[model samples]
Target: MSWMPPDLPSAARARLEAARVLVVGLGGLGAHVALLLARSGVGHLVLADADRVEAANLSRQPYFPEHVGRLKAVALGELLQRIRPQMGVTLVPQFVAPDALPRLAAGCTAVVEAVDDAATKAALVEAAVAAGFRVVSASGIGGVGAGLAVRRLGRLVVVGDECTPCAGATPPLAPRVTAAAALQADVVVGWIVGNDSGTED
Candidate 1:
């Protein structure tokens, strides 16, 4: 696809095309991460989310007005398939528990944690690490800041400001949320490529 940069090394592109990533949560962060990964030619995506799209989600999420009331996993799976019909996508239309994360992530090349709940995020991170799956997670995108910071926690990489929590008074805006999601996507892509080339540190 033209979206895949011509300058990208064939090996990297091949790796991306062969990658199977698990994205937990189809909210603001996961939605964008899924779209970006599909466009970037990631071969397979496993999407999990139990929530249905609501009007409030239209503001910050990658869903259309018609998607309101539709299951996020189903909607996102359809969107990804539309974007890349050749891409393989699995939709788990249910909330994935932290304890179940390891089993879900075991078959994936990497995992992306984008759930709004901090406890769930932590649990998933722990589970992914224990399962030996490289994982990327988001921290704070609920505030006004558009800036993103990346932090490494063991085998997991975290993206977003370390300070702002979604529970804060500041409401989440598209710019900040999307920025964090983009960072998460980039990190996931990098991890896939690095692992494929045996260059991951």
Candidate 2:
């Protein structure tokens, strides 16, 4: 019944188990973040996304072929439940409105922003921070061969390069996108374990 890895301190594992996270997208980055958090023993996750799985998402996101045409939130929720059947997962099948973010984030220890739109990301970050929840926002994982980086500004932690945009020009291959998502997940874990100095390079 113990979920902690042997190397993980009991205190850290307890912290992770008590944490609730809200993931505000189910794309490549959000999918990875949610999956990692579940595997890492986060007790609860609220997944919000309006889009359905598409064939194109299979290349970079975590959806299986069978998930295509299903709601991303529902698909990811099912996958997370399969991974950790005891974990609490709430699926919101519609896009989260910016004004509702504070209410959604009220009890969450952190908010992970994996939406593609810059404006939406900004609004989410602002709302999460204002609500006193740690926020991790992703950007620039659309291209190939770019390394990952984590930077913190105030209560907001930004993961991935600031230069890469997911325009039609460069496809978001799985490697780079997953790498960014891993970084986002790691940052959240760090915060949960009280090891984040808020200035990771």
Overall lDDT per candidate, in order of appearance = 0.86, 0.88
lDDT of 1 by residue, 1-201 (tens): 455889999999888888899999999999999999998889999999999999999999999999999999999998988899989998899989888887777668889999998888888888888888888988867678456778777678888777655453678888888888888898888887884211233
lDDT, candidate 2, 20-138, per-residue tens:
99999999999999999999999999999999999988989988999999999999999998999999999998989888998877788889999998898888888888878889998
lDDT of 1: 0.86
Best by lDDT: 2
Error of 2 at 90 (Å): 0.8
Clashes of each: 0, 0
Q: Which pairs clash inside model 2?
A: none
List the lowest-lDDT window of 10 residues for candidate 1: 192-201
Error of 1 at 149 (Å): 0.6
Per-model TM-score, in order, reads 0.91, 0.93
Identify the runs in model 1 with alpha carbons over 4 angstroms from their true place: 1-3, 165-168, 195-201
